[model samples]
Target: MTGPTGLGTRTITPDLARGLLLALIAVANAHLYLVERPIGYRGYPSGLTGADAVVAVVQMVLVDGRVFPLFAALVGYGVARLAERAPESVVRRRGIVLIGIGALHGLLLFPGDIIGAYGLVILLTAPALATSSSRGLLAMSGAIGVFVVLLSSGASGPQGVPTVPSIAAPTLGAFLAGHPGEWLVTTLFSALLTAPAVLVGVVIGRSRTLDEPAAHRGRLAVWAAGGLVAGVALGLPLALAVVGVWSPTGTVGGVVAAAHAAGGYAGALGLLGLMGLLGSVSWPGRGLLAAAGTWSMTLYLSQSVVFVAVLAVWAGGLGSSASLVTATLIGLATWLVGVVVAGLLARAGHRGPFELLVRRLTYPRARTSDR
Candidate 1:
């Protein structure tokens, strides 16, 4: 069942799940590069057209903070899959590789990168998941939840992207073409905010539900339903506020933020469960998505490349001019390209270039045949 630094069983669902996740990541990230308006919740743009307002509303409710936790869940699942065939050292080494790549990625292109956060969590939690009792891990998760609650409790303000006077798509150039120190602070804050979701992902990984989702459909169904309901109940009001429907100020705002902080993760888990349920049904383009999942790292890095080229001031300079509809189209195009290219690469029997590099780093002495 083992493959060097790769999944042991080659399950289609996890990769398929990853494929869908990349699209969400693309949409979630599109807002950060926008310069036409002030930043709103998690970098979503403000001053919307009717269409943009609707897009923002949908994204806030479904896309914003939900995607990364699902990605983290997949990462934890990958670690678990690796554990089934390799030693703990192997998992740790892979985590180190991710950290290095993530750090470099954040410094060079996007400061909001979640890969680094996931890497830190892997380094911190791999051992615990391997050795701790389920109760112990649950307790640890509870502690992390409390910390998240405390960190988010101070939110009593208007809901929107924070306006940084000196920072814009141009200064984003600093991250893309400059040094690590420039973006390090932003990167650190982003990583901290992402840590709780990563820990929750680790717990889900231990469940082994995603590992063989078909066998656990009933349980996943309940989780999918409950998580979906909880997520929407907490998320909808916030979305409405972002689009100027509801007021997210004062105690109401603080409560809304807390709900969002918690509900985003719930939504992510619900999506994961839903995806697992859908994994059982036959679908078109399933193979393409599976391939994209297998090549996720390469595709993820590629997304930043596309963003910089299309949006950065020094490049295509679409930053302020690109509307939500335009951004959505760009994101869709990027995702489609990722799926197609990944499928072609998979068909050619080649590992993604970045994936191969990571495997080599993770297992330096291991031969290609081992993979």
Candidate 2:
């Protein structure tokens, strides 16, 4: 079931979840690159209308905060699996490489790069992740979750002002100069925000929940049902406000935003549970999705590349001109292209270039045949 060498046997649930996550990430990030707009909750533009409004609402509830936590969970799951086989040094080396790659990606393409944040988490928590008991991990997750909720309360800003000034930087030079500082802030914030999900993922991986979904069907079902319902319910108020339907201000708005942010963890778990259930059954296009998952790191970086080219103010200038609807269409197109390219690579028996790079760098002396 394992891959030719270093990678563990690919499982259906995690791979499928990762493949699906990229699409959500694409749509979630497209609007954040927008410029000359008054930012609102979660960096969405204020005063949306028509289809733009609809898209914003949908993304707010289902995609925005949800995807990143899921991505964090997947990374943690992989870390847990790697820790089972590789030495601690190898795991830390992988984290270091990710940080380097993430810095380059953030500086050159998108300032919202998450790889570095996850790398930071891995670097700091490697020992704890490998040794923590279930109860201990859950306790840490709860503590961090409280902190994240508090952090998210201040996430809202005055509706008519730009929240992230760097996103609207006027010139390429200014954008590049401002990005490293922004990336530092974002990496720290992301690491804290996603810590709980990562710990939860380690718990799930330790239990082999997705690896043997059929044996844990009952638990997965509860997670799927409860998590999804809670996520949508908690996210609704923010979605409404973002789409110009509700106008909660003052403390009420802050509470709503915090609740919405908290819902992201539930949504991530819900989606993982749903994927685990799905993994128990055979379906069409599963291979394609798994292939995309195999190349997820490469595809994720490629998304930023495409977005910067198409939407950055200093590039195509579409960030200032494209409607939310158009940007969403572009996101979907980008994901589709990634899927096709990933499938071709799979068919050709080639690993993703980035995957190869990481493998080579992490295991410097390992032979290609062995790894």
Candidate 3:
């Protein structure tokens, strides 16, 4: 929490804003591996009728790529909250531990893991978020976000805008195999792409707009409306392109789609507004949302384990047995469970078990030398 500046510290009060996004992520990420065309266990499930194709289309466009954008944007938000109360040295040391924890998360969980990405984002981007004027930082973040889509998607530069350094998506194993600089290059792109999202979080933290609902009501409503429009405008096209409803292969199309998915980034931010709108008016559900936010890290890690171990690993592999429709249901169920678990657990005078571990590890030990 922030001390005197009052720029961006909150009570660490829970908000349901990010709870939904994190939950959606489990389902969305699972869908990537689970949905297969009707066929046998190993092959794409064959014999799909037209109905199945339709389901595929909806999931592909809306759910698949959209969730990560949401998750990444939230990570940006997280960094902003921390910078208010902590020193850079503190953020940096904490980031190192997060990187280690993320590495452990990767080793134990999915190879295509997000924790590492989030950790990498913090280690590099925290300083920038701390130093830049929020508006300037936001602008820089927008430029970088656009650049990632344009350059990495192998598309024409943004609006035929020229991009100097094109970034490539690298496989973790390949990344590990490559020279030391390769990993830096990979993370460099992540830092660039995610920085804006983090800045937005910082803005929210500083604003306390989400916390004092009555005071911020009108402002949040306005922000929510703008975010929804941006998400739709940018997200739909990107999902369609990736799903091949539009041509899937071109660099330009990919960039466009990535930008579209970026809409979800906007949506998530606006969602905080939407949540505040509801909570401002409602009494019962508001408490639940706040509770969930309190145990967010626990819920977040719990999400990862459940997805990889239970949801995706169902007999014959998660996708092997389930259709996209089934997978979505599983993901939703997982999220609901997480909220309940978080709420119950938070009131029981504890954080998430895993989160406790993360905290213990992330906090530095006094060096024997220093002592």
Query: How does each model score on lDDT?
Result: 0.73, 0.82, 0.55
Better of 2 and 3 by TM-score: 2
Clashing residue pairs in all predictions, respectively, total 3, 0, 17
After the best TM-score superposition of candidate 2, give how far the Cα of residue 227 lies from its true spot, in angstroms: 1.0
Q: TM-score: which candidate is best?
A: 2
User: Model 2 over residues 1-371: C-alpha lDDT tens digits?
Assistant: 12224334567678777888888989988888776777776677878899999888788777878888989988888887877777778778878988888898888878788999998888888888667797898899999999899888886544564434566777889889888888889888899988888888888888999888889999999988988888888899989888778787789988998899888998888878888888777788877887788889999999988887888877777988889899999999999999888967765677888888877787787764323
Per-residue lDDT tens digits for candidate 3, residues 1-371, read 32222212223233465665666666555554443332221111333335554555454444444556555655555566657666786667556766666565544444445565667767776677668787777787678776665554554122211011111112334423332343344345545655556666666666776567678889879867886666666666644433335544455555665575466567666665666677567566555555676566667667667765553333235654666567667777878887877867665555556555554554445221111
Clashing pairs in 2: none
Clashing pairs in 1: 39-161, 40-160, 40-161
Instruction: Tell me the deviation in Å of residue 175 in model 2.
Output: 1.9
Name the TM-score of candidate 3.
0.75
Model 3 per-residue lDDT at 368: 14
The 10-residue segment with the lowest total lDDT in model 2: 1-10
Task: Mark the regions of model 3 whose C-alpha exceeds 4 Å error after superposition.
Answer: 1-14, 35-66, 155-191, 238-255, 311-316, 365-371
Query: Candidate 2 — what's its lDDT?
Result: 0.82
Runs with alpha carbons beyond 4 Å of true place in candidate 1: 1-8, 155-182, 369-371
